[model samples]
Target: MNSAKSPAKKSWLQTLIKNKNERKKVIFIFTISFLLVVAGLIYIPIYKHSLPLDSKIYEGNFKELGSIARIGFFAALAIYPIFLLLKWKPLSHIKKGNFELKPLIQFLAKYVRQWHVPIALISTAMIILHGYMALIKGFQANFTYFSGIITMAVLACLLVMGVKRYKRTDKKWHLKFAISFLVLFMIHATFS
Candidate 1:
């Protein structure tokens, strides 16, 4: 009788309320990263225009790259939330310790894990592309360049550590590195 009601009688909201700490952490990480990305998009152009005319990176014709950078920025900005939503389903399961390594769950984890790195890479790439354009057509390469470099490093670390986490069947390093990278990248993006 108890086994039968176990799945049906439990409410999702109740479960969240019970594990508020983890849920809060998840929300915090997502919110901070989202804000940073959005903020970066807004400030990048202003920073670029602040560059001196003689800077090698900021002096080139960048109309096309600028347009592409805009597209890339918006695309990256939009896709991140969707990716988070998709992973949220499984994340809830994992948090509940209900993650059975069955074929379906395994398959979902595989695809979702694969999806994350490329999205992050593309997002970082777009940021870099934007920075490159700014370097050539604007004066302030210091902030843009430093931000781009840090973003790339964070993404790369996330990817490498991510692969290890997935294959090792451990979530410890995954959470540590993933959260660290996200936080650091957000800071770099927003501060630069």
Candidate 2:
């Protein structure tokens, strides 16, 4: 009976792993759990050392720099989705049917594709600067900061996947990571 149950359990596990959607669900669940654990670990220390709400660090230009960085980041983030919209099936049909708009849509698509990587890199730099300034200000124990940290981590993974995609070492992972990063960033931004 024990041996028979072991084989059944093993086959069940194998089936779960063999299914692509199931594998993705498992990975997503594990990733969220790991991030939560990491967040908890980091949050405690940061919360302990966090400054009072009214405490001002140096009255330097951090705020201005952060604002600029955010704008730059959003500009970069918008490129890919805009490019997607340009290449959407409905839009493609319109482009095919409407000769006048074809040139405009094609031009926009090409331009956006050309700028995607460069803008992403620039935005990454801006995010780094923004995060550094935020750290200098103080790490308050809040959902906003936690979400930002998670977004940053996802962005790092997205960057790696982007490089892999560029090098032809990967195919779909970059897009998946990009979508994940976008969702996480939106949450972070909205909360903040």
Candidate 3:
């Protein structure tokens, strides 16, 4: 009886892997797990006093420059997701034979796509500067710092995926990374 159940269990697992929605759920689970592990790695050292913190370094205009960088980062980060919404939402409508807004959606999507790469590049630079300003003031083991590091790592992956997508060397990973980055960035921003 145990042997008879073995193939059935294996087939069930295989079927789950083959299903698109199930596959997505599995991928999401794995992604979240990986991110949690990363956060733990970052948080544990600071929690244990292995990491040094010097609050004195926060002097000077670092705060002001960090604020400016934050503003620039937000501005650039805001645009790309609009493009994704514009590009994607219309497709579902179109599938249902609703073409009333097709032309307008396409036009907006095209315009947004044109600006996406440039804005992303600018945002990357702003984030780098922002990170430098913060770290120069010493590392603080807080939600904001932890989230920021994870968000930055996600953004780096997003940038690489974006470049590969642009060069036609890949397609789907860029969107995945973009969504991940957006979610992580939101968390980071909220804590800040």
The candidate that wins on lDDT is: 2
lDDT of 1 by residue, 1-192 (tens): 455544456565445334455445445544655675567566655775575545555434343443444444444344345555555555435443654434454565555543443444445444555555555554555865676566567656655665464356545665566566556556654565
Query: lDDT at 93 for candidate 2?
Result: 54
Model 3 C-alpha lDDT per residue in residues 11-119, reported as the tens digit of each score: 5435535545545554554565456445644654455353333443443344454455456555545556565666575454654455555666667666555545544
Ranked by TM-score from best down, the candidates are: 2, 3, 1
After the best TM-score superposition of candidate 2, give how far the Cα of residue 36 lies from its true spot, in angstroms: 31
- Which pairs clash in the backbone of model 3? none
Better of 1 and 2 by lDDT: 2
Instruction: List the candidate numbers ranked by lDDT, top first.
Output: 2, 3, 1
Off by over 4 Å in 1: 1-114, 135-144, 169-171
TM-score result, candidate 2:
0.58
**Alpha-carbon RMSD, candidate 2:** 12.4
**TM-score for each candidate, following the candidate numbering:** 0.36, 0.58, 0.52
Worst 10 residues of 3 by lDDT: 51-60
